[model samples]
Target: MKYKSQQIAYWFFALCILLFALQITYGFIMGFARIGWDGLHDIIPFNTARAVHTNLLVVWLLSGFMGAAYYIIPEEAQRELVSVKLAFVQFFSLALVGVIAIVGYHFNYWEGRKFLEIPRELDYLVVVNVLLFLGLILTTLFKGKRQTTTAMVLSMGLLFAALLYLPGMIWFDSQVMDSFFRWWVVHLWVEGVWELIMGGILAFLLIKLTGVDREVIEKWLYVIVGLTFLSGVLGTGHHYYYIGVNKIWLVVGGIFSALEPLAFLGMALFAVYMYRKGEKKHPNKLALFWTIGSAIVSFIGAGLLGFAHTLPQTNLYTHGTLVTAMHGHYAFWGAYAMIVLAIISYSVPNMTGRKRFDKTAGHMAFWLSNIGMLGMVVALGVAGVVQVYLERRLKMDFMVAQEETKIHFVVMLLCATLFTVGIVMYMYEFIRYGKPSDEALEPAA
Candidate 1:
């Protein structure tokens, strides 16, 4: 069932790793700056580092998702990619755009928007790149012998994700109008269609690693999708509550935001139930760990913690504070980042024909990274709570409150170093796998 065309994914994954390392570097810069270590303030100020850090997170995760698509679509569609050369072209174009954008960030050549900062000129190129990506994936799926639900769901997610980007691209003079539509892109992506993407990927991994029936796994997927749309779309109202929008959003947003956790809960329950029910245990235990861990941690990070502050009552105080950062870091790590690493863990072995699944370093990478991230989350959560009390409730000066939280950033940095070490171990394994070969495409004995 393996296709030679899947080899192209390896390159995208390599790019993903490179960008991720750079993201961590910038994250460290911000972390240190918080702790009064501003050695690179003149050359690369905190604002520039923040932009690079966040944007790189988005780019690298997209790269990983694209790699997953390239690998999964061929196998699920039961055919080779429609155009490997064009795929490579798409890959290189993506990397080039990302490089230009990240480099431009350092020079202040970006829009000041939070997530959508790559400016309008580069936005056009992004649209084209995504269109090309969609065209290839959809064409291959349609032309293939059979289009399974997993393939269709994954494809639908990708297509919808591309369409959703349009809202962020539109220009608006009013700050109210801009912020309103911005949530359409930001809130909707993470809570809405992106969940579809996560569900599809999770379904695929569950089917493979757990040896579960596709019928059963995909049935859970249908429920997950239903929950996601039902809650996530309306949940965008939560952002509208304080943003000069109508008051109706307060009620609407609170209700739906409360309901949002059900979608992630459904995902978590589905993964766990399938794992316990399955008879065949695949040897790729590390992938299983990540797959299962993604499901569980997402519920905790995205579901519970998001519900913690998303209510209008709570969000009023926590908005624009480090509390938001606490939620964001863990949610992204659990929902998107871990899943990407899971797919990489699963696919890399198959592509390279090397089964180093049981390495102690692999286990250490999983545990150390998870532990480190949890520690960081705790540190941020503690800092955020103190900030809320000092700055928001007590009306203390923001700078003074930030100074009070300096010690927490030191704790965050210590944990971040551990996180970086785990990632380095992961990169080591990826490099050790070397390149994919034609022999990998041949049937196993």
Candidate 2:
């Protein structure tokens, strides 16, 4: 039974690695569009690679989310997963559906929505909903105790994400309607529900790894929930600004999004404050690197950039440009990637029951990924600023101005290359010296 659970966890991890590798390759390939002109359309078109990139990000994120849920539910409940059978079934079902959807996407059969780009018909979409709902239901029943506020909030968010996704999946004749609902699922997932999940997981990890009492953690959880709902429920208005809507979204999005950064920044400060106040006997520094770094960078990248572009004044320059992509890349990294790294750090040691490492491989991997991402963020940001200067300040034609700053694209491509190399090193360390020794970290395990 133990072997089976561990095997399932690592198997999902292997999938994550594969997706990460693909994402890296496509990332580089897409960069070629800017730096060079190979005319590789139909093979690895910009649109095609972008779908791959975003979809892979979602899949790999879910892999980590599920794997962590499988592990933590047991520890909190004082029982194993209700049925490892159901667990594996849920995992594989997700994988199979992802494969089918992505294959269709690769063939250019998609409905042409950004996040909701899967080409599956309504029937297949329904199957996905059922699979997700069933998995959540089973996991919840198995969890037993309902008092773990943080975990429960996160799980409920996950469940609600599944539910919210259904309405957006309804087949529509007009592509615009499809596009609208697509944001419902896309923005609402990452911006709304995933933030709750992030709070839950971050709280749990800090409590366990930082040796803080559950009481202290739960207090923080309550605050987190308060801030998330206060900010996120209204903050989603940010997307409504440019989506061809007529609901006074500019005023609404601006006000709310201006407040949204407070939530992210709050989370970061809370994590750091708690870490400082709690125990300080740090283990392998890599284990907590992303966990801690995520809080800070997410606040700055997701929160601050969101603030920068929230205004109608600024977004007119930044919209659909490299600045927006910079925000996406960093926000995803700071929020999702950092959390995923923390989960791996927390789970891999427990799964392998290892305590220490001989060399600095894990640490190196952490720095590489973190630094690479930071590099991408800064480079892209500079290019974006340059764009604003060229198009807005200079009052030049759009494409003409964009062409004048071709050097920025080249620099951006170089940044992506650096980012990819970092992910490689990080993945290498994860595959190699993941677990140190059984005797050292047994108590935590």
Candidate 3:
């Protein structure tokens, strides 16, 4: 950290770890429920648990993105954050809103939308919080001595993400209309603007860790940005295939969504090529592993797996089944979750002035979580295939098919436990790094 204000990112990252742990816990609850352990069914049913699990994933990832912006924006712009105090305010308010939304789920106080389950009133608070966050980021970027492409891409992603949330908040009487707009938020964020955010962060990390020139990295960033918009925007059609939309989406969605993987493929090649091209002297090997790992894994999870069922022919059978769940788990974790972890792994040692890079536990945490998640994805994928064949193909009863899949949920639970253990280890590393301090600040090399 070359600026004291960047320390504000520490708290946000800390919150991210906390919420992520809670998210895993709820995942366990649901996994257990799937196997007929209804111990907490009365208090926290499957529906509520699923909502909390997914929503927490979003909240933690958002926190990590905010933290990345706070940490990266100032350094790239060559100035301190515009307002650290307001940054703290935005942090707490964002956490408060997330906590309230999650708690409300247990009591059935939420919208029925899948990922947009947070109530409309709380959605207003989220908008305000995000606006405050963006205000600080944009103000600092403009006020600083320089504005870099890395910073602009990241800021644009955040700005567009905030704007995209509005469509989901609108009140629509028709279910079809609501679903249409909902994809604007969900698909567009992950597959669209969020890729810009990832590319920006990846560029920044590569510049620091790889000793790669900014011009080289930012050039690749432009390719990624162009690829993302070209493919991802129309990729939303994949969701519209069976959602009562025009039959045209069949061709449109299949073609465009298949092309979506090219963007991710570009990202993967960009990261690996940059890594191979750089000096590679940075001792923060863990961060490098995560940074490189995120790119390659995202291509697999988001690109390949997503393509498997993205076409109308496959999705017609796999829609709303565990197949989607399988893709969702891996894609979100690979693309968004790993990038967040990469940023955190890089920033923590810098902020806290603790040089515990490449610890045994850190390596274990990465491998375990990723392997565990892969195992879980396979479990779910197999379960989904069985489910699709049984219910959709064989025309079996839904409950009977669900009963047949209980064994896979058991496998998922086992893998999730391994995943949770990795997360706990990572969180331990986070705590061991201790709090951020001014002593950590140094002149940028």
* Backbone clash tally (model 3): 0
Clashes of each: 0, 0, 0
Report lDDT (Cα) of residue 210, candidate 1: 92
lDDT of 1 at 147: 91
Number of clashes in model 1? Answer: 0
User: 424 in model 3: Cα distance from truth in Å?
Assistant: 0.8
Candidate maximizing lDDT = 3
Candidate 1 vs candidate 3: the lDDT winner is 3
Candidate 3 per-residue lDDT over residues 225-312, each given as its tens digit:
8989998898899999998989998998899999999999999999999999999899999999999999999999999999999989
- Per-residue lDDT tens digits for candidate 2, residues 1-445, read 1332433565566677777788777777777776666477767788888888888888888777666666555555544455666666767777776777667667877766777677657337545644664465446545565547666766776776667777666887876676667777887787778887788778878877687788887787778767777777776677776767766867877787788888898889888988888786657456667788888888888898768787866886677777887898899989887887787776676676654432466677677677777877777787778788888778879887767656766776776666767777767767774542334333433
The 10-residue segment of model 2 with minimum total lDDT is: 436-445
lDDT of each: 0.92, 0.71, 0.95
Error in Å for residue 117 of model 1: 0.5
TM-scores for every predicted model: 0.99, 0.90, 0.99
The alpha-carbon root-mean-square deviation between model 2 and the true structure, to one decimal in Å, is 3.0
Residue 341 CA displacement from its true place in model 1, Å: 0.1
Q: In candidate 1, what are the lDDT values of residues 267-314, reduced to their tens digit? A: 999999999998756999999999999999999999999999999999
Candidate 1 residue pairs in backbone clash: none
